[model samples]
Target: MKTYLPQIERRILVRPNQTYGILNYDLDNAYPQRMLELVAGSPTAKDCWNKRTKFIAGNGLEEKDLGKQIINAKGLTIAKLLKALATDKALFTGFGIHINYNADFRITSVSYVKFEDIRMGDTDNAETADKFALYSDWGRKTWKNIMRSKVTFLDKYNPEPEVISEQVCKAGGWEHYKGQLFYFNPEVDDYPLIEADSVWEDFETEAGIKIFNNREVTTGFLPSTMLFMQSRREEAENTRPDADTYTGINIPTQLEKDLGAFQGAKSAQKIIVIEYEDESSKPEFKAYPIQNNDKLFETTERSVEARIIKGFSVPKELINAEKSSGLSNGSEKKQAILEFNDNTAADRLELSETLAEIFSRFYKDINPGKNWNIIPVTAIAADDNPGIKAGNAINELLQSTLPRESKIAALVYAYGFKQAEAEAMCL
Candidate 1:
């Protein structure tokens, strides 16, 4: 009898925007306008993310433009463009780039496109997955009047909806073509945009918390309410009436007039009041003052601060901010700092790789086989006592029975010592 083997079922997961010739409704429904609004309105989000970008894009990368003199247009340079990219990425959680080159093999210009204006195109093929088209609200402004106008004032008040521009790129070509739709495909090595979906919510939340804190701080954190007291309406009718006193005016009406006058005055005055007493044996009065409740939200504020720090992936101690948990000892604090530096180094490497690939592609298109190098500089973070660490490593190598010459060479190279100096130290 012949035996049959069972085959395992498999599935390949792709980005939400990627579908095999099928429209991705989820990505289409992502309400980017609101997301952009949320991020744009957040100061904390801008600060945290921008700081990271600034740290990674320090001084920009060194590049060989192949004598194209591309940066001359509008006094633009690689560093300025990189800074713009960093800022766009921080604010929009994505970066969009437009490369302009001439037919004579020269990279004429590189522009950092706004993320809000980009729409992802065909993703069925890896070659075309990174393709996109840009939409804009330019030339949509209209004149309107408040009353009896052909265009309604409300239409003017409302933001003009973005419409796709004519400019677009197709797959496997450097030529840009016009299109009515908001999508296009490009056969590029990698996507023209780098996006982070997971961190977007964190950025929005951090921004919202910061806005709330700012508002609270400005308003003097308090609970405000309205208080109304029904005063006795009966007037004190003296059996012996006097012309000196006036009882015709209502207490509430007089109070309102006094308040309006006091508020309208140019000079500041303190301790003003409209005193009123009822003729009834028992009088009633009530006051509602804004009660401060800052202490109640202190914990929430701290928690939000911690979350914002974590979202930015920064070391709190670096900014002189203290965390409520862990990191108790000196070693722990040191480790925290080291970890932050490591993360920064990793970011630098990743950014450099991406920038190098992009520049290489652009440069190669203009001048085939030309040199374009993008190097990211990162600071070295070693142990608190490098001498001790080196000594321990050297001792370990010695006990492992490594060659004397190899050990001496290692000492000289690792510790940045001269050959003679290392030899004398080893001796």
Candidate 2:
């Protein structure tokens, strides 16, 4: 019995907020993609959901827009991870047995899923077993419900003879998962690197191997603590022409109906780009009235600009999407760049510095609401780079819902973070 075990490279980011914050992403220096980045036998889209330690991207909005966001974000990233497991479905999805590492060691892997507009995230941006328990419960309650025709069934009651272990064998107890390495914890408990597969191919091979290469990925939430897993499959099994069908810029269908006052030139019109500079942090954006005339926008609003997200306080006009009626023209002087130094990550991330400022501000704004007194998404939408878009996607991906006066403004933040992170890593 010759079993081939392909290694997976996992990439973990520190995501206190919704954005996939890269702590120390060292992909360029990692192992050769072919040497330690491919998984031989992986699960298919259908079977992947039945497992315990699986990832799922539910339609998770602010629990407020809970209704429609569900229709959009369902199965975004986790679904893709399953299909790219390995070439040999037999090897990839094989259940011959299992591997068990403890609590300190999670079964993590890396993929280009987050690189592009690779959205699709777990329900809670914060990871916990509870968020994923539904998948396990659904499978256990009615296995017959989700089983497909192409599924391989080895036996009846002995259907899962492929392995000695049952589903999730926890830290304390063990049932059918006896002879096998159920779980062993060095610090707390043990976790298995089950159906998950990790891989890395340069900017070259990523597109052809992905599931929905046609869609422009704007917003996504990913587990921040993932480990980088890498691997490469043979050309035959992994070969596929690069897909050019993806809509480069995704405009929600609903926004099409609501472009009322903001409709500029195209259905996706030009946005009012306003950039404010800060000595302490990255530049932030502000939205001006969409200039109907091109020649006018240059003189009136100036060229495009971006924001400094690390600042203390965002201008209220930006946060509320209030009309920038104050600045009638470039000459009409108003403090467009608001200063937020005494209170925020704008200064530093030290516990004493950050926390003291945070609590002090909490006391200051201890009124009702999360405080829309924050900066507007447009105030940060002043991206100068040809690539960044700053609206819902960036806010969603970055987890900052800065209000937008228009649909294009909304899409700016949604798409900006991807472009920003992409640029950051490419450098």
**In candidate 1, what residue range of length 10 has the lowest lDDT sum?**
151-160
In candidate 2 the C-alpha lDDT for residue 305 amounts to 12
Best by TM-score: 1
TM-score of 1: 0.50
Count of clashing pairs, candidate 2: 61
Evaluate all candidate structures by whole-model CA lDDT and list the values in order.
Answer: 0.46, 0.24
lDDT of 1: 0.46
**lDDT of candidate 2 at residue 310, scale 0 to 100:** 11
- Kindly report which residue pairs in candidate 1 clash with one another: none
lDDT of 2 by residue, 1-427 (tens): 9999997644432222133211111232111121123221111222222211121111111123212211112332322332222121111221121122222222211121111111112335433221111011112234545233322111101213232133324322333321221111111221112122232221113222232222212112111122222221112222235434543534333323342323423434445332224443333234445324435433322211111111112333333222222212322112332232222222122212311222232213222233212121122224333223222234343344433333234333433323333344223
| lDDT of candidate 1 over 294-375, digit per residue (tens) | 5545555556655656666766664432221121334554565566555656455544554555555343454355433334
Candidate 2 residue spans exceeding 4 A from truth: 1-104, 107-170, 173-314, 319-323, 330-427
Alpha-carbon lDDT of model 2:
0.24
